[model samples]
Target chain A: EAGVTQFPSHSVIEKGQTVTLRCDPISGHDNLYWYRRVMGKEIKFLLHFVKESKQDESGMPNNRFLAERTGGTYSTLKVQPAELEDSGVYFCASSQPGRGSPLHFGNGTRLTVT
Target chain B: GESVGLHLPTLSVQEGDNSIINCAYSNSASDYFIWYKQESGKGPQFIIDIRSNMDKRQGQRVTVLLNKTVKHLSLQIAATQPGDSAVYFCAEKGISSASKIIFGSGTRLSIRP
Candidate 1:
């Protein structure tokens, strides 16, 4: 089976620009998640989707960030008016619904804001 | 992939030697833990995982040991090879959220020829 896939492996944008990152999860996977790693930091969770409903989104950084999972098949994360601090690797992961299922990750989209 | 940190702690091991990488997780409430290996320009790949109910789990030449009392975890690779060189991250699935894994700072494993 194909693993999780992310689009536009790298993106460069100016401050105040809008950028959208997309992720396609593995087939039949019900759980999708977003995480990011800023320079010199550990990967932090951003949000999660269980099908079309958001399971959790407490980790979202600010109001400028938004995420959507249409039809509960794929997900898109949008950053409006991106800032310099938004530069980082955005990773999307998915896993089967289970207590200990391992998450499959995508290569991630590297976002650079100047 | 983007470089996530300024300097990650590195472990250098000679080929054909056993290598051990350690991690300390913060949440005692975590019931499941995982180890991931990420090569340059690639996503993190799952290595192995251990549940809170167990102290040790083994997978193809790799072993993960968990010490719940001290909240420490370690990954041991037998007969380490050059291909094993990568950044290894330990993640915890806390009881706080559903399948939301939290990652550590990561350790870079360098193989010596």
Candidate 2:
């Protein structure tokens, strides 16, 4: 089976611009998660989606960032008026709906804002 | 805020020797712990996992030891090889946090010839 796949392995944007990252989870997976890791920092959770509904979004940093999983298949994260601090690697993962289930992650999209 | 952390930022081990990486977590409520290995230009891959009900779990050449008393976790690799050189991360998940997993700063393992 194919693993989780992320689009645009690398992205570069200017400050105040808008950028969007996409993630396609493994087939038949219902739980999708988004995570970000800044340079030299630990990977932090961003949000989670169970099917088309969001399960947890408390990890979202600010209002400028938005995430959606339409049709319950793929997810997209958008950052409007992006700031330098928004630059980081965004990872997407998926797993079966079970407690302690192992997560399968994508290669991640590296975003650089200048 | 509760967080997970590694004791060392990096480790160097000679080939054919065993390697141990240590991690400390602050959330005593965490019931599940896992370890991941990440190579350059790739996402993290699951190595091993241990639940609070068990003290140790082994898979192939890797072993994960968890001590709930001290909120400590460690990963031991036997017969370390060049391919084993990568960044290892320890993560934890608590029942209260639902399915969210907390990750720690990774420890880079370097194998010397």
Candidate 3:
């Protein structure tokens, strides 16, 4: 079976520009999650999607960040007017619908804002 | 604010020796604890997990010990091999936090052959 896959393994953009990261979850998985890790920091949750519906988004940093999971198959995270502090590695994970299911993660997209 | 942290930033161990990594969490409400391994250029992979109800759980060659009173967690790897070199992270999930899992700064493990 194919694992979760992310697009544009690495991205570089100027400050104040817009960037979008994409994630394709494993097949038959209903739960998708987004996470980010800045330099020298632990990975933090961004949001979660359950079959096209937003399950939890409290971890989203600010209004400039937007995440959408259309049709529940894939997810995209968009950051507008990106700031230097927005540079980090964005990871996507998916799991079966269960309380203790393990999450399978992608290689992640490394975004560098200059 | 709730947070999880590791005791050391890095560890160097001899091959075939056991390696232990420690972690501390501030949230007493957290009921589920997990360990993940991340190699360069890859995302975290699940290692093992233990619930608050259990003090210890063992996997193939890894063991996770959870101490609720001290809010401490530890992962023990037996016969540490070169392939085991990676960043190990300890994470906690609160009972009411839905699917959000809080992670700690990882401890990098380096094996000496």
Q: Model-by-model lDDT, in order?
A: 0.89, 0.92, 0.93
Better of 1 and 3 by lDDT: 3
Which model scores highest in TM-score? 2
lDDT by residue for model 2 over A1-114, one digit each (tens)? 999999989999999999999999999999999999899588899998989999999899999999999999999999998999999999999988887887889999999999
- Order of candidates by TM-score, top first? 2, 3, 1
**Deviation in Å, model 2, residue A61 alpha carbon:** 0.8
What are the per-residue Cα lDDT tens digits for candidate 1 across B2-72?
Answer: 11221238889999999998887666688988999998888889999998999999999999999889888
Error of 1 at A60 (Å): 0.7
Worst 10-residue lDDT window for candidate 2 chain B reads: B93-102
Off by over 4 Å in 3: none
Model 3 over residues A58-85: C-alpha lDDT tens digits? Answer: 9999999999998889999999989999
TM-score of chain B of each: 0.90, 0.97, 0.98
Worst 10-residue lDDT window for candidate 2 chain A reads A95-104
In model 2, the runs with Cα more than 4 Å from the true position are: none
Q: How high a TM-score does candidate 1 get?
A: 0.94
DockQ, all candidates in order = 0.61, 0.66, 0.66
lDDT of 3 by residue, B1-113 (tens): 89999999999999999999999999998888999999999999999999899999999999999999999999999999999999999998877535578899999999999
Predicted complex 3: DockQ: 0.66
